[model samples]
Target: MLNKTASRSFYLNLWLGLVGLVVGIFAGFAVGISPALLLVAIVAVAGLIWFFASFEQAVIGLLILRSSLDLFSAQQLPAAFAIALNALTILYVLVALLTGKAVKIDKFWWFFALWIIFQSLWVILLPLGGLGMDASFLMSGVRVWLRYFSWLMVYLLVMQLKDNVPPEKIVSMLLLSLVAPISIALLQIFLPSSMLPSLLTSQGKAGSNVSGTLGFPNGLGIFLTMFIALVWWKLSISSKRLPWLLLLGLVSFVFVRTGYFTGLVAVLLLILFINSTKITPVRAIGVVLFCCAFLWMFASTEFGQQRLTEIYDTPLLNPNIDVSRSIILSYGDSNSFNWRIAHWTYLINAWSQFPILGYGLDTSPLLGIRDFNTGSGYAPHNDYIRFLVEQGVVGLTGFLCFLVGQGWYLVHLLRNSQSVNSRRNLCLILIALFVANIVSMLTSNIMDATTFFFYWWTLVAIAGWGNEYWRPNLATKSA
Candidate 1:
């Protein structure tokens, strides 16, 4: 009797399941299978994963995806990827808040939050207040706000994880994130352009310059500079240092190939600082090998030869050349050191018109895009000047405060943290990266959607994490 009842129930449930499947298929077909539906599905899945996964896992996955995204051009990927990233970030923050996690909010974070809020308000008000409210302009402003908010969310999420997650795990995740981009960059250099994705080629100009997977050489340079510093720092302290040294050499090779002068300067400064400390015989030999390999590659590669020529041949270095003439001439040619100087002048002049508040969020690019024909646009190339032009004095002040706050905090941490603690080494690495980024920003807009944002805020997140959980021990050591 029990068997007969069970068989009947199973058949009934199977029939209902079949009916539901048919209904779902009909519903999907009726919806016309648009991109929007696909996007919704993607978001749903990502949301579920974030909801179920541990915070550390979710963040690591996001960072890896973000690094992968750097390999493809923006047009190549669906908008859903970006949407999902933002949604997951928000979800993480909401969950943290709901779970009553002890979030570490410092003065720097408050300043940054204020800066974001200030910029976002202008983004909304500027469009309605005589900026014409065109959809394109408004959308551009919106995108800028989204980037800022996404960064904030990441920082907050990392802060929440400080007590729960191990520092080694976080560092490993960061190192792993670089593997894909570095590998792709190495491949691009050796493989013919025709064999690789056309989008990966620098501006679709064959053999022009390799941008790696970031689609922009300077962007790749910024990314490489940060990791190079981190790897070098790791090598300085680790007993098993060979792997770090090898990775450093690989990254340094790619960094030199990018031909970003500011990044080069940052790396040189990092080397000088690191060398100040005692070096073991092994590390010294590794450094010597890295230098030899770099020199050989630099001499052998066409791109490297051209970059060398450009660096040495710049007229700005000539004592005979008038500074004004050099600036004028270089600005005409584009992508020159003097050109950057001229660009800064133009942006500062423009900023004078609305120096108090400036234009608005993301407006600098719109204003500067007109100059794209000259091989450089209104990007201001310098993030400092870019912010000055867009946000003016008030916005610039807030940004500086946030930057200075971070720098001040890190310096304190370095002074107090125990020499033996891993956090101290990590703090030094973060300090070096922060300096490198600041240096790179002087010549390139390093705060954009590229690897810049990911690396920058990762530093911030780590710093925040350290400040919250690691300070007591550091304080004791200092005392």
Candidate 2:
């Protein structure tokens, strides 16, 4: 029976591969994109063939492509090509799980599972709620809802690696993954604008803040921040931290060069909090001085000067004020913070109509159409507004509960930390990120930033696996 099942699966995958290759070819040709992109399409098809051949290969392939796909969005690649790849990704992972493939499932898994259930329900019923009836709107919302599945897949696959793969092997894989993103950052920094493809670049000045592989400066910030934390954890535990010095330096350079302040701000706060972990006073002082020096350099940059000197016209709240989106945007020097405030105001008003279950997942862009003159909407920017507008009150409630539980769990781990330096450092970084996220999420997309979260949750899932694998030791230590 197993042989027959395998034979059938192979045949089905073969059929799908042929169809996919044909479609990918047409997609490449239809766009009349450069020959270079056509070559990429060929490579993509070849990669897909490998993915379909084995579940393990598919999982690993996704990890390897984590950074690239972030840059090669619908903006870089054709929309059809991007959707096809993402849909195929979702299909393969879901099929594997349904076919009795086991994954790590514990207390946190329940939290993840329950909230995910609501996402599907939102997709099906959003049209009825008068939110996602238009084809584009409905499809957009569906894609956003399904985005979680991609992260779920990453978490499950990474968890599986804990026992079967050695830590050094995973470290090596991460080192390999670092290549493309850092290379792109260097290109953006050194190469002239005319030398790079428009798809690979954004509207940043030549000398400052460029989007690396993640397509946006902030996205690069998030990825590099998580990556830096991972490196720190590795070095913290290793007897010979010297080996990681070069890798650390490369990552740090790209991180600083990108000039996305979000991750830096978060890490700066974290460095101060690390004193609670009982580092030497001298080391703590050194960290403070290093941060201060970096801040001085950062503030001296033209872009940093603009961001720092800008003022928000709208206060956080006021009973008497005409703080509409247009009004907020009218100021020639309007801060992005005020823009978020205006967009959020419009989203909240529309969300009031569907307060129970929200209009639909990812519909916030369309829901805030009233705020946009171009008749196109923007992201809520704030994850709180995102959940409140799309997932509604119930979803938000579930999310907060899950967050509180996660924070508690991390605290518990830190308090009763075993003799493992790596694990303790892991808990510290996670907790710091958790707290930082609470602040960042108020102004950034924390939940559905797939490219960034894909890596973030992979590290997190390793911690989840560690929680189970080291339970006996932890229990003994607690006793």
Candidate 3:
């Protein structure tokens, strides 16, 4: 099944990476000036080769990569290098199958692959035939497209590797991988803002925002939400709860610092859902009271003050009324919101032209709309609006299926879960995160946020590890 394209690209990156490593070493040797970085490169190349030799290493190595490196940071990496990481991984999967690696991939994932290919082509070809994508746009979108595949690869890799490795070991390594991101975020807190690079401290003054290594507070907030859920699970299973509990508290403060309230809301929801099996009318009332107190506390934060004001200005937007240019929109126009209402309104009206089919994948932003004052183009802040306007109804439906389908599987697993104590913890955290992420997607650009989805898919892959209820339907009806 190896096509000519796949075969050619299969070993190309590995060979190239090795050659580059050799050339650099010789260049350093000939000059009699090998630096510490050259040594690091040598070790990294060795690690890359080791990853190539073992799927288990590749999966764990990728965890290290996602957590440690800034995936989209332009200053830290060449665009080609970042693409190569995932590109070579996909090629590795092809190599694995060709070499007869024995593993059973779930059928749902196979179908998901087909959808991604179809959608990618739709975007690529449409732009080629019409607007003719420039190099920057083309490259940016390719990275986005590759991430969809990386999600599948991580899932399949975990599913295959789980048979030999304890899920705890894998999860533990992943949690340990958080050291870099946490350290970087912590540096922004204690160190002076001027001490850090501007890219690392996107919030200007470091104390104002905790962008972390991910380089954006909003996306970092979403990523930490996952960490919070998982850390909660770790707290449940660990004999040494002090460490996990401390990590939980520190991470929560950083999440709050990010000023991305949507993530905060999601984490709250996750906590509530973890109590779903025990919920009663009295508990429900207590939940409402607790939420009110939490929101009140949140409104005291700088970002929360802005958000609370916006909500207060509007109270509740009446569906029957049109307030596109009303007082609520006016309040949001001046701040970090930057008039999202006007942007969404304009985009929706434009989308009416091709409501069924959409403009094309990743083409919604090409509509050439801009803010008058800033004269800067705004990304579709809302993903649902972006999908509808760009990929249309069909694209939106397909996306909803991907998100909803995962939730459906998680819910089913929990409902029919076996008596394995460890498995219950995994189910609760995973399901909490799945539902929480969807809620966060409404305000921010979750689809384009590489760091968030990279970790999101990894979490999904490992969530079912070592669990009996996670088998494919063909294998058995239930655990």
Candidate 4:
């Protein structure tokens, strides 16, 4: 594919860069040149070369998508988006045609399929039709599909890896990802907005504790809960020198400081449940002490003190302004809880109207009520309510299959699983993470698509795949 001229240009550029870097380094001694300048130049050249290499790599990834992903454009999405669904469809067809083996539809698949059918049917039957939802086709529809596309890729990757990868490897990846979000959260909480120009530019807002790569405080809280669960799971069974205790304490501190009530509750439950499994009174006291210390650390900080004082004075302290809107307009205060309540009320009303199919897929409960400023009536604060609104009863039922199935599955796995320390620990970890995600979703509606959904699906895939560890030869027999 490479032309001789282009190949020559590439090699020439590479050699020129190498030679230039060597000259710049050597010249620093004789010409009194700054090594920092030489280093910067080399870095710049290396970065340019790497950018070219990434282009080639991205092209290969895109090619595997069979033209679904546009690699040549500057505004391109990841190839994984296209590759995921293609892989699933190919798997299904191959199983059907070549082997004459019909893909046995499980209850989970039935739920999902029914939900999709209901969504399609509703779209067709609506008086205004699908055109109503496609009003902001570019922004809303495109964004929703892109997120689902991302979810598809993540689902495929985890499912494929289910058989081969060890639980520890998955746990490790989860632990490593925690660093990025935690680091970003810490920066936002501690650093001035003007300090990180790049992150500020990307995020569109700064100086708020909740503003991070995830774009919301609640998202970050959810992430923290999941990450700590991973750590807790790893620590419970391993004899290795893991700093899980320290991690638990640190994350708990961040969780409380985040002001995300659900996250705090999830973490507390995780600690209590895990420790109570063995029923050590000493550990129980330690947990209580740790909770107090965590509370104390928050109360010591100015923000923490004010928040605590406000909570303490909630009943007595009059808001003196409308509390039913997302943006609270009280003097010296801003609260969105009232708006969530109103939106939730509106969502409940919407559900009552379309009890069976709801208001079509991707339609938020607050879909019709436009925001005065941005006109974006998208995404209620609740995931379960949002699912009911968009997918209607069918969607809710399908999701319930996943929710209730996972719960039953976790209990079944935990009870019947081999009584090995590592396996038991892994089971508990899964349970904690599952509980944390469900709890987090109560306050934030993120399961549809986003990093939250990706992580949730990854955990589910891991559960399905990892279950075989406890039931050896099960897949072979099922196949």
Candidate 5:
């Protein structure tokens, strides 16, 4: 009778605890915190709880939050979301350490950490002969490092959680998150501007380009390119292939409408690479014929004609001077292409002045490279050049080492992974994603684009997870 009484007390107390927790959460919401923030808080708490209970659920929630961020203007979101994620990451690492989980630390992460430390020191010291540091510039540099570190934290979290989550689940969560963005993008393309939210409307030069919920057409193109590769890879290994292929076709069409030449080229190269092993003499001839036919058909369209005109109208070639110099000098100061060239030239010049360490993070714009018309400082669109001008040889070297290390690890996984076919397909997708990103970086400041950076690292973390936990002999392989 005493034992029964104690059990009843325990159950009642447990129920009251849960009820009190819910009421407390409601009370906080009722006290007039912004709905956005309240929502983030609720999600964060739930995610933390889920993280402790089930690692896979926490990862899925994180991915969903990350993907949803693209739809809204990032500036409007609360910083609490990032704080929550970082807190969870730190806690997870501590727990893993306490529990003796075999946490693998990639050497690339150390290099990246060194790079961040170097930037932090440079910002603090404000060394002589560097770009003059002001409070505003210093704060901006701090913000840059904070953002980089936040993303890096996510990468680290994924590394720790990789063994706990299945690769297929990661892919599924990514695809599920993509559904809303993809649907919105396709709708914007078909629907009139009046039917869409102003935020979702096309802001590109032509009314035809759709940014979807990503807020930038080029960003959408990059996002689509990565997923298109993913969907294509998924189709290649699936029996229910037609639907995925159709989705890929739709995504490819939208990607072209973005009119981002670099993204398009990257996707094309990815497709070519994927098909390289299948090419036979007969298939090669057929491929060439199909390409010729497609080109002929494309030339007949008004849109294609405009695109061709834009390409040909550019002064790419001149007969009056040495070919190389003429090509180099052809870009007019006012031309967009020339603008990028000018930025690159300026960055190169700036890097030459400080070859070893450069001006420091976020200092490129302040170093007297202003737009002539607006007199506003501009960033070099190319990340490589920006790194050269801002972080210099030491920083750039660290950056390169990280990239090379990541590539090596991916390759190593591909060669040695005896995982299920789904896992291998994911590995291939990661390789393709890396290639596409590298190519896209040539034309855009990809590292600075938060949406792309988050997705890229998240995917990498997923791949790493697959490498560790998704192998055939693992207990969860069947999962």
Candidate 6:
């Protein structure tokens, strides 16, 4: 018994989604719309779907562009798309309260609900809307919240629809998401530098292609790390040789061109974590051997060699004499370690200026001080710094409180997990993500934007889902 609006929304979503897919799937920038305008259209369509179809349509939108659109074009939309989906999801969830659906909220949903409410309050109380009725600022808020809403929707959808969704479907969706990014990264690796500029022109940034698929080299590394971890988990659950083989190939290619050591750390941590899972020793050994082959390939490739050279080229990690020391220092030595140290220093120093309320909600870029390194008008590379700069200390504190509370909740779930095997596996994945975030934040500080933000929230929701779904059963078994 669907209402008329719901029914109409579904049909419109289906048709509009198809139109978007057709336009976006091929070339020519969707029949004459400038790349920028096409991106806006994509965002608009995403917003419409999210508003009407709950979070389901948001996922559909993500899938549409992610699977069909060319990487060059697709990257533009995902960041905006994620934000749109998140906002709509949050709005819908809040609205559901009037329908008595509030009773369905377990503890995890409650935490998410609180986060949404807090964000809304911050939006209202602070200068989030900007000084006046600026369409650009308004649109930006819409985009930011969309990602948060998307993750919420994903979590709610997964938890509620867990029974309805086949394992294969879940696996397929995730696999597809990673596949597009991996393919693009591989292209960057194998393709000539002369050819890269055209593909990367979407970023419209000067100098160097900004690592398509994940939007940067480190970002791509994160994607690879997550996929490799996922593939390991899948292998533990099922013995599908093809997925393992394919994932191994993708993972190897990602690391070779990443030029960042984070992937190596992620892979190492994932392997250790998987070993702790109940995966068979035989399978684990096979994975290790497979990874080694990929490592060897990484070392052999031209791109791999270049990336490898960069690893040793720096004196930051290696105090030993490295030829690239002068070059890195010229680029800004103190700011080079992802600029976390330098950026954090600046943010801390600047906090007293607006300590309590901060610079107003999402006003870091406005301050002009945080954009020191790239000079591209970006948020602080670290979420902590960005949160403080944008939301101020008060807003940042609220967010931290929420995160810490969620972690405490996870502890209870971990202790009470029904199946030790699944629980352990879940723990491993969560830990890997946590560690990855630590590395990203400590070094680079790039988590608050785009698909990376989407990844962070999705992982959180997944952790919450696993906790709620498995805890009671695990507790009973332990007892």
State which candidate has the highest TM-score: 1
Per-residue alpha-carbon lDDT of candidate 2 for residues 1-479, written as tens digits (9 for 90 to 100) = 89867876876677567777887767768569677777767776677667666645565666766677666565544234335555664655555554544554556656666667756777777666544234446777767766776566556556655566544345446646677878888888788888988767653333578767777777777777777666765665555667765576667667776666666687676656654566676677767675776676667767767655543244544334356643556444456656666677778888888787776777778776344456767777788888888778976786687778778877877765555445566678788778877777877776755666766666566665453444233222110
Selected candidate, larger lDDT, 1 vs 3:
3
What do the candidate models score in CA lDDT, each in turn? 0.65, 0.65, 0.66, 0.55, 0.65, 0.55
Model 3 scores worst on lDDT over the 10 consecutive residues at 470-479
Please give, for residues 97-206, the per-residue lDDT of candidate 6 as tens digits. 43334423357777887787776654564344433223345546555555466666656644543433333344446666765666665566566657766655453222
Please rank every candidate by TM-score, starting with the best. 1, 3, 5, 2, 6, 4
TM-score of each: 0.80, 0.76, 0.79, 0.66, 0.77, 0.66
lDDT for model 2: 0.65
How much is 131 displaced in model 1, in angstroms? 7.6
**Per-residue lDDT of candidate 1, residues 326-375 (tens digit):** 56677565536666666666677778878877777777755543554565
lDDT of 5 at 101: 55
Q: In model 6, where is the ten-residue run with the lowest total lDDT?
A: 470-479
Root mean square deviation (Cα) for candidate 6: 8.3
- Identify the leading candidate in terms of lDDT: 3
Put down candidate 5 lDDT per residue, 30-113, tens digits, no spaces.
558677776766665675667878886766777666655655655644245566677778767765554445666676667667
Model 1 has an lDDT value of 0.65
Q: Tell me how candidate 5 scores on lDDT.
A: 0.65
TM-score of 6: 0.66
Clashes of each: 1, 0, 0, 2, 1, 19
Model 5 scores worst on lDDT over the 10 consecutive residues at: 470-479
In model 6, state the lDDT of residue 299.
71
Residue 323 accuracy (lDDT) in model 1: 51
